[model samples]
Target: MIVATGDYHVLTDILVILERWTICHRRYHHCATSLRLKCTEL
Candidate 1:
């Protein structure tokens, strides 16, 4: 498997971005669920 240096860098950047996005999305989903639960309790 031969990958160009530049392509490898780009792929690494994309993976980092995807990891950050997934973390953020999970946090947002958790917050939304909590808010909904609080609203229902009120």
Candidate 2:
């Protein structure tokens, strides 16, 4: 039972990391695109 609980905690942590990574990646892409557009305009 303890092992199972530990595994669950690990899985939850991994999920949180993945979620944050995806969100950061999306924001980075958005910022990059806007910067590219600005550079093109200049």
Candidate maximizing lDDT: 1
Per-residue lDDT tens digits for candidate 1, residues 1-42, read: 999999999999889877766666655655777654544342
What residue runs in model 2 are displaced by over 4 Å at the alpha carbon?
1-3, 30-42
Q: What TM-scores do the predictions have?
A: 0.60, 0.58
Question: How many pairs of residues collide in each model?
Answer: 0, 0
In candidate 1, list every pair of residues with a backbone clash: none
Error of 1 at 26 (Å): 0.7
> Which of the numbered candidates is closest to the native, going by highest TM-score?
1
Tens-digit lDDT track for model 2 on 1-42? 356888899999889877766666655655777654543342
Clashes of 1: 0
Which lDDT values do the candidates have, in the order given? 0.68, 0.65
Error of 2 at 12 (Å): 0.3
Alpha-carbon shift of residue 35 in model 1 (angstroms): 15
